[model samples]
Target: MDAAYVFAVRFRLDPDRGVAVEPETFETRLRRPADDPGESGWLFFRDNLWRGDLADAESFRGLTADALGVLVESVEYRALETDREYYDALREAIAADLAPFNADSVDEVVSKYLGSSVEIRR
Candidate 1:
């Protein structure tokens, strides 16, 4: 069966705990399997997802994951619509973007859909 491209964005709502969600948050740290290549994109995604109110925190649809000794408020995921003909164009765009950093073609799927959100961890 053909695989799907899915973006899983991890967010920690309690800023008081001091989790740096800023751009380059993954830099300076050792590269791990769960590290984000670009926090800038995640920040952009989170901003667009915000609804002007965080009161519905519990109502937000997401899975739960522990991060920094605290539960990340939401671990949301979205699959891309890859069956469309436009997917070919999207793949080319993503391949160009990730070519500078990776040698594998597998990243084409992840980066194409998560380009504006986050990257698949190494």
Candidate 2:
């Protein structure tokens, strides 16, 4: 099984750079293994999130702009969608990794990074 961190992005093409198109919107997903919560490269939440939201919207918009070659106007955090089995593993991993963080429990860590945006699907 796999999980995805999903987001909604709104962007526009720069007229100076190329033929300008109308502003557009789309949903994007960064996919990962459902069970591998401790994978080093799977630290997207830790790196990009703060208190359940993007740590820096301007930086995120810049990254999106570069990736899509457009002017990113806005970004909205959606949810971390995964299965119940994987969610359990992720909570366990968060508990193990809690030593270095300021939180005292896995729930705190999850709340800090993901908040109410976690969706556990069957």
The alpha-carbon RMSD values of the candidates against the true structure, listed in the order shown, are: 14.5, 2.9
> Would you estimate the TM-scores of all the predictions?
0.26, 0.80
Which parts of model 2 are misplaced by more than 4 Å? 15-35
Q: For model 2, how does the per-residue alpha-carbon lDDT over 1-122 read when each residue is reduced to its tens digit?
A: 46777767877555665566554444454343433677765668777777767888889878877877877787766788987877888888777778766789988888888888999897
| lDDT, model 1 | 0.36
Candidate 1 ranges with C-alpha deviation above 4 Å:
1-72, 106-122
lDDT per residue for candidate 1 within 1-122, as digits (tens), equals: 12233334344434567565554222111111221223233222222233222223454323233323434434344433233333454346446565543436735444433444333222
lDDT of every model, 2 decimals = 0.36, 0.74
Clashes of 1: 0
TM-score, candidate number 1: 0.26
Worst 10 residues of 1 by lDDT: 26-35
Clashing pairs in 1: none
